[model samples]
Target: MNTQIQRNYEAAKQIYANLGIDTEKAIVKLKDIKISMHCWQGDDVRGFLNKDQDLTGGISVTGNYPGAARTPEELRQDLEKAYSLIPGKHKLNLHAIYADTDEKIDLDEIEPRHYEKWVQWAKKQGLGLDFNPTCFSHPKSDDGFTLSHPNKEIRDFWIEHCKRARKVGEYFGKETGQPCVTNVWIPDGFKDQPVDRLGPRERLQASLDEVFKEEINPAYNLDAIESKLFGIGSESYVVGSHEFYMGYGLTRNKLICLDAGHFHPTEVVSNKLSALSLFSEGMLLHVSRPVRWDSDHVVTMDDETLAIARELVVHNLISKTHIGLDFFDASINRVAAWVIGTRNMLKALLRAMLEPTESLKEAELRGDYTTRLALMEELKSYPFGAVWDYYCESSNVPVREDWLKEVKDYETNVLLKRD
Candidate 1:
C-alpha cells in the first residue's frame, strides 16, 4: 500500500464522516456496480463482418488513428489491456457485427454460436456481456431505414436479426450468470420531412411488436429499446424519437435506453431518469458526451454525467438502472478512450454514493433550500480525488493520470505494431 494514498484516504474519510457519509461504504458500493463498456470504441465501430464498408446510417467515426483493431482477436486484445487499467470488474457491450465466428453470415443469419468465443473469453476474464443488434451499416439500411423501412422484405430482415440477437443475449446471461440486456436501436427516418410521419412510426411499432413476440426468461435476458432524436441521414426526421420509445417501452414492458448523445443539446438525459423511473421497471443509460449533436465524443467527468450518477444514487435507482458507455474517438488511443470514459463513470458513481444525501433530502423536505444549496457548494471542495486514488490503489490499478503511461506503453508495443 502506498503511504501517501493511505494518509490521504484517512484524512478524507474523516471529512466525509463529519457529514454522516461513509467513504468506505461508498467504495464498496462502487465496486459492485458494473458499467458495460462498449466494444465499438476499440475499432471505430467497424466490426469484423465487413471491415472495408463505409459506415452507413447517421453515425460517423471521424478519426483515422493508426492501429484500429482489424479482427476480433485484436479487438479483444485491446479490450483486455483496457480492462487492466480501469478499476473494478465490468461487462463488455458487444455489437452483432463483432461476432467471433468465421461464418459467411449476414445480419439476419447470425446466431448465438457466432458469439461463443466472446462468451468463453468473458467467463475467463470473470466479466459479463451485453448485446446489441446491428440495425445500421448494412446495405438494406443504406437508405437510412431498418425496422421501419417501407419494404416488407427489408423490415423482416432486421426483425429476424433482432430476434436472434436476443438468443445471443440469453446465451451470454446463462453462461456468465449475469442477465444480459439486448438493446435495439434503429436509424429509420427520412432526410427531409415526409408527408406522413405516423405511418413510419406505426410500422416501426408493429415491427418492434413482432420482434419482441418471443418471450425469453427475464432471469437470463432483458430487452431494451433505444430512441434517438435525430441522426446523420435522418436529421430532418428520426422515426425512433424519444417519445416513440417511451410509449413503446411502457406498453411493452421493456427497458427504455436513454442515450446521452441521442437527445437534443438542451435536453439532458439525467433530468429524465427520475421521471421515467417512477413508471418504467428499469432503464439502460448510454453515458456519452455530445458537442452539439451526436458526435459520440469520449466521456469526461462533466456536469451531466455527474447529475446522472447523482440521480441514480439519490432516487435509489441503481438496482434498476443499467449503465453502459457509448462513445468512440478514433483520433486518440482507442484503448485509452475505454479506460478514461469508464473510469470517469465509476468515479461519478462513487462521488454520488459519497454524498450526504440523507441530510440533503431532509433539508429539501423541510424547505431549507439555502442549507441544501450551501452544503452542496461546500461539498464541491471535498477530498474526492484522495479517496478515488486510494480506491484505485487498493484495486491494483494505476491512480490518476498514472494510467496514461501504461496506455502509451501499450500503444508503442502493441497498437503501433499493428499498423
Candidate 2:
C-alpha cells in the first residue's frame, strides 16, 4: 500500500470514529455487497447467436467502437479483464441470447446445456450468475410485442422462452449455490396511441401467469419482472409501464425490477426503494445513467447513484435488493466501461456504509430536523475518497485512476488486435 494512502485512511478512520462509524467495518461490508455486471456491455447488446439480425425492440446501442466482442470466448475474456479490476466478487448477468452454443437453436428450444460452459466458468471464478429472458431482437418480437402480442402463437413462443430461461436460472443457482434472479422484460407497446390499452395488459398478465406456472425452488431461482415508461419505438404507450408491473409484481408475488433509466427524466429510483421494500419480498435494480431519455449510458458517481446507495444503506435494504448494472456503451473501451461502472458502484456503496447512521437516525427520530439536515450536508465533504482508496488497495485492485492505465494497455495489446 502507498504510504500516503495509508496515512489518509488513518486520518479518515479517526474522523469517522468520532462520528461513531467504523471505517474498517464499512470496508468489510462493502466487500460483501456484489453488483451484478451485465454481459451485454462488452458486445454492445449483440449476443452470440451466430445470426445476422439487427438490434430491434425499443433498445439500441449508439456507438460502433472497435473491438466489440464477436464470440462468446472474447466476451468472457473481456469480462474477466473487467472483473479483475473491480473490488468484490460480483455476479454476471446474462441474457438468453448469449447462450454459448454453436448449434442452430431457436429461443424456445434453448436448454441448460447451452449454458454449461458459462456455469463452469462462473464456478471457476467464484461468481454468481443472474439471467434475463431475451424478449426482443427476434423475428417474433419485431412488432414491439412479445408476451402481449395479439397473435396467440407469438405470445406462446415468448412464454416458452421465458420458461426455459427460468430453468437456466435454476441451473445457475444450483451450480453456484446462490439464488439466481431471472428477470422478464418485454417491449410490448405501440409507437402511436392505441385504441385498446386494456387488451394488451390483460394478455400480458395472463401470459405471465402461464410462464410462472411451473414454480422452481425458491432456493434455486427468483423471478422478477421489469417495466419501462417508454422506449425509442414505443413512445406512445408501454404495456409494461411502472404502474402495470407494480400491480403485477404485487399481485403475482414476484420481484419488481426498477431500472434507473426506465422512468421519466426527473424520477429518482432511490426514493422508491423504501416504499417498495415494505411489501415486496425483494427487488432488483438495473442501475444505469440516462442523459435525457432511456439512453442506457454507463453509470457514474453522480448524485442519483450516490443517493441510491445511501438509501439502501440507511434503510437497511441491501439484503432485500439485488443490484445490477444495466448499460451498454460501445462508444468507448467496453472493458473500461465495465471497470468504471462497477468501481463507481462499489465506491457509492462504500460511501453509504461509512455514514454515521446511528447519529443520523437519532437526529431524525428526535425531530431534530435542523441537526439532521446540517449533518447530511456536512457528511458530503468527508474523506470518502481516502476510505475508497484504502478499499481498492486492500482488495488487491487498482487504486484511484491507476486502473485506467491497465485498461488502456489491454486495449492496445488485446482489443485493438481484433479485426
Candidate 3:
C-alpha cells in the first residue's frame, strides 16, 4: 500500500465515520459494481468487417486518430491495455459488426460462432460480455431506416439480425456466468417531418415484437430497448422515442435503456433511473456525454455523471441497473479515453457510496431541508479523492494521474506504431 494514500484514507475514513458512512463498506460495494466498456471506442465505431463503410444513422467519429484497431486481435489488445489501468473487473460491450470470424458474413447472417473468439477472450480475462445488433452504418440502414422501414423486406432483415444478436448475447451470458443485456437501438425515422408519424412507430413496435418473439432465458440474456430523442437525419421525428420504449418495455417485460446523450439537453438520465426502477426488473444505461446534442463525447466526472452514479447508489438501484459506457472520442488516445471515463464513473460511484444517504433521507423525512442541503453541499468538498486514491493503490492500479504515464507509454510503443 502507498503510505501517503493509506494515511490520507485513514483521516478521510474517520471523517466519513462521523457521518455514519462506512468507507470500507463503500469500497466493498463499489468493488462489485462493474461498468461495461464500449468496444467501439477502440476503433472509432468502425468495426472490422465494414472498414470501407462510412458511418451513417447520425453516428460520426470525428477525429482521424491513427492506430485505430483494424482487427479483432488489435482491438482486444487495446482493451487489455485499457483494462489493466482501470481498476476492478468489467464487461466488454460488443456490436454485431465486431464479429471475429474468418468467414465473411453480413449482419443478418450473424451467429454465436462469429463471436466465439470474443467469448474466449472474455473468459480468459474473467470479464462478462454484452451485445448489440449493428443496426446502423450498414447498407441496409443507408436510408436511415431499419426495423421501421416501409419495405417489409428491410424490416424483416433487421428483425432477423436482432434475433440472432440475442442468441449471441445468450451465448455470452452462458459462457461468462453473467447475464448479457442485448440492447436494441435503431435509427428509423425521417430527416424531415412526415405526416405518418404513427405509422413508423407502429411498424417499429411490430418489428421489435417480431425480433423478441422468442423468449430467451432471462438469466442468460435480457433484452433492452434504447431510444433517442432525435439524430442527424431524424431531427424531425425519431420512430423510437423515449415513450415508445417505456411503454413497450413495461408491457413486453423488456429492459428500458436510457442513454445520457440520447435525450434533450434539459433532460438527464439520472432522474429517470429511480422512476424506471419501480416498474422494470432491470434497466440498461448508456452513460455518455453530449456537447449540445447526441455528440457522444467521452465521459468526464461531470455533474451529470456524478448524479447518475449517485442515483444508482442512493436509490439502491445498483443491483437492478446495468451500467455501460457509451462515448467514443477518437481525438485523444482511445485507450486513455476508456481509462479516464471508466475511472471517473468508478470515482463517482465511490463518492455516491460515501454519502450519508440514510441521514440525508431522514432529514428530508422530517422536513429538515437545511441539514439535507448543507450536508449534500459540504460532501461535494469532502476527501473523497483521498479514498479514491487509496482504492486505486489497493487495487494495484495507478493512483490519481499516475495512470496517464502508462497510457502515454502504450501510445508511443504500441498505438503509434500501428499504421
CA lDDT, every prediction?
A: 0.93, 0.92, 0.92
What are the per-residue Cα lDDT tens digits for candidate 2 across 1-419?
88999999999999989998999889888888989999999998889773487898888898878889998899999999999998889999999999999789999999999999999999999999999999988999888999999999999999999999999999999999988999999998899999999999999999999999997998999999999998878999999999999998998889999999998888999999999999987899999999877888899999999999999998999999999999999899999999999888888898888888888899999999999999989989999999999988888989988999999998999999996
lDDT by residue for model 1 (1-419), tens: 99999999999999999998889899999999999999999998889987777888888898888889988889999999999999999999999999987788898999889999999899999999999999988889889988998999999999999999999999999999999999999998888888999999999999999999999998899999999988877878999999999999999899999999998789999999999999997999999999877899989999999999999999999999999999989999899899999999998988888899999999999999999999999988899999999999999999999999998999999999998
TM-score of each: 0.99, 0.98, 0.99
Clashes of each: 0, 0, 0
Q: Which stretches of candidate 1 lie over 4 Å from their true place?
A: none
**Which regions in candidate 2 have their CA more than 4 angstroms from the true location?**
none
Cα lDDT tens digits, model 3, 1-419, are 97888999999999999999899999999899889999999998889778799988888888877778989999999999999998899999999989999888888899899999999999999999999999999899999999999999988899999999999999999999999999999988888989998998899989888898898998899999999999888899999999999999999989899999999889999999998999986899999999877889989999999999999989999888899999888898899999999998999999999999999999999999999999999999999999999888888999988889998998899988997
Predicted model with the maximum lDDT: 1
- Candidate order, TM-score descending: 1, 3, 2
Residue 85 CA error for candidate 1 (Å)?
Answer: 0.9
User: Runs in model 3 with CA error above 4 Å?
Assistant: none
> 309, model 2: CA deviation in Å?
0.5
